[model samples]
Target: MKAAFLIPLLAALWPAHAPAEGVAGDFDYYVLSLGWQPGWCRATGDRRDARDCNPGSGRDFVVHGLWPQHERGWPDHCATDERDPSRRDTQAMADLMAPGLALYQWRKHGRCSGLSAAGYYAALREAAEAVRIPAPFDDLPRDITLPPAVVEDAFIEANPGLTPDGITVTCKEGALAEVRICLTRDLEPRPCAPDARRDCSRSRVLMEKIR
Candidate 1:
């Protein structure tokens, strides 16, 4: 009877197991994040070294990542049997994203997609190509301060099938940071999950000029 009581006390003192992260290939949709290059460079002070921030780089909105999302939460750094991307593979994506970012995305979000590194990058490219960048953002001759909603509206107006519910504009340090658009597994526009639909509430966010 004493041993039984001791066993119960020990069990009660043991820590509870943390919830497991989502498994590979088990997410609801995708979030294609496009980073505003100038804003990112300004906010993070990466202009001195980042190739994407270099003058004459001509980069405006670059593919940040294509992430697997749940209806409620998201997943990251999932375990996968697929091999990590090689330098050649990451370098091939330099036109769209920095090589380091390409490799990191493959490790974090891509691993959850249950695709090989090659297949994941291919899908990322396909998803990015499907979205149209509003022409106005192409050449911002001067810094502009506008409501975040205006940016979202521009994207919605440019992409026929995309609605406000399918896209969100995020800001960092009162500057436009990223434009995240939800897409189906097939890369079609879709409504974002409630948790993923949070937009930047800033009244007027700065948009740095293209470098």
Candidate 2:
């Protein structure tokens, strides 16, 4: 997953300064960032999460986190009413989320969702389940190059209720990085924030193979 590595890398690179406080339930929508695992590992380094990068895993997209977003910038570490997931809750979350990325999401985004720890995570799972991966990406195993708009169109065609405005295709150095989808708090497809749209300006983006 791109954000699976991106968030942690960004956190490491972020300045060691006090972050702004967040206001609970103050956002407009949610952004479910699904990372293209192989694309990230290739850019970051070979020494990546073995479970995800191993040649036989056969997983292309992985849940990075279900983040709460605003019309402009987003929120993080809202009110310190944070609660760690319990053992049982952790097990349930693992069913849909990456283990390492789970805690970061809770601390950074989940805490600001204005829902209980259990409720927030449940929403994370719900958001993930709501989207249907396009057939081309449903079970990717080899690297493929594609145009960002083409990928976005595939996703829109696969998901009946989704539209171009509902999704964005992110790229890194002309490589497909992630596909960010926007959804309402209740999990229905929604248009993404103008700023949250994909940042790639290239005609072709490389999607590294899962291996």
RMSD of each: 5.7, 8.6
lDDT of each: 0.88, 0.80
Top-scoring candidate (TM-score) = 1
* Predicted candidate 1 versus true structure: per-residue lDDT over 29-120, tens digit per residue: 99999999898887674836766677876778989999999886787889999999999999999878879889999988999998999999
The pairs that clash in candidate 1 are none
Best lDDT goes to which candidate? Answer: 1
C-alpha RMSD of candidate 2: 8.6
Off by over 4 Å in 1: 1-20, 45-48
